[model samples]
Target: MYSSIELENVEPRELEEEAPTLLSVGRELKPEKMRPNVWHYERGEENAYHRQGEQEELYVVLEGTVDVTIERDDERDVITLSKHDVLVVPPESWRQLRAVEESRVLAVGAPNVPDDGMLEE
Candidate 1:
């Protein structure tokens, strides 16, 4: 039988890493085209444009709010994503994200992280 766990002086660690002058999580995500890898996307305070590969992806909101833009051949769709909202991004579509209020999002993709810039838009 599994024993009940007990808390022991647990505390949240203070993050000390400096924010990137130019956000490149979009580029960093290019090579890691796999699922189950958790990425902490710092607030860009601006919109970031990107696209997914052949693999499917799911973006789950962890904190704050964001606006997700999905681009198709004929039309562009924009949706507001807030805490607890899961956004599914299909392959071969142009996507961008804007942190509405210092938000945090989790992106999960299948297979391997696709090569950066798989779509042209």
Candidate 2:
């Protein structure tokens, strides 16, 4: 059996308090090995600084622009991504994303472990 659903049809999930709108694509699609999410950010909205224990994530900017900050070993790097831009982040690297404008992003991560993420203060 196969399943198909349009992105616009899925309801947003309240995964983060006071954060961007999140659509859980993997939850709707039910893929076995990966988790995918679509995030809609208003201007100045941002996610928290966090890292995953075993999941490597790929983020693609679907609309507008965002600034992704990555931290590793006391060093931090900020990367600006526009539409169609992609960023790959390693499992242990902490990352945060802030919207430069109203934007949409597609984030896919492997292994799909729900409890493997850690947030920084």
Candidate 3:
């Protein structure tokens, strides 16, 4: 069996006014091993810094640009991604994404574990 959806047809999740619009593609598709989400961010908006306990995540820039800040141990790095760029983040790396322009990104996490994320202040 297979599932398909046009991204524009997916409903966006209701979140804080400052938060990016989120579309849960995996929720709609009912994937067993992966969670896929799409994020629509306005320029200058950002997500919280957070890390997963056991699920690695992949981020793909689908439109515009974003800066991904990753912190591990005591070190930090920022990587800029334009359309079509991709980044794979390990489970324990603290990371956040800021929109450099109005942007859309696809994030997918493997193993589809519940409550695997811990957000930082």
Error of 2 at 1 (Å): 4.7
Weakest lDDT window of 10 consecutive positions for candidate 3: 13-22
After the best TM-score superposition of candidate 3, give how far the Cα of residue 112 lies from its true spot, in angstroms: 0.7
Q: After superposition, how far is residue 45 of candidate 3 from its true place, in Å?
A: 0.7
As for candidate 1, its clashing pairs are 32-113, 33-112, 33-113, 33-114, 34-112, 34-113
Error of 3 at 3 (Å): 0.7
Q: Write the per-residue lDDT of candidate 1 for residues 1-121, one digit (tens) a residue.
A: 3222221222222333322122233333344436533333456553346676576778887777878889978679999988999988777788877776676666767766544436344
Query: Distance (Å) between predicted and true CA of 38, model 3?
Result: 0.2
Cα shift from native, residue 65, model 2 (Å): 0.3
Model 3 quality (TM-score): 0.95
Give TM per candidate.
Answer: 0.62, 0.94, 0.95
lDDT of 2: 0.92
Better of 2 and 3 by lDDT: 3
Would you list the rank order by TM-score, best first? 3, 2, 1
- lDDT-superior candidate, 1 or 3: 3
**Ranking of candidates on lDDT, top first:** 3, 2, 1
User: Can you write out model 3's per-residue Cα lDDT over 18-117, one digit (the tens) per residue?
Assistant: 3798998988998989999999999998998899999999999999999999999989999999999999999999999999999999999998988598
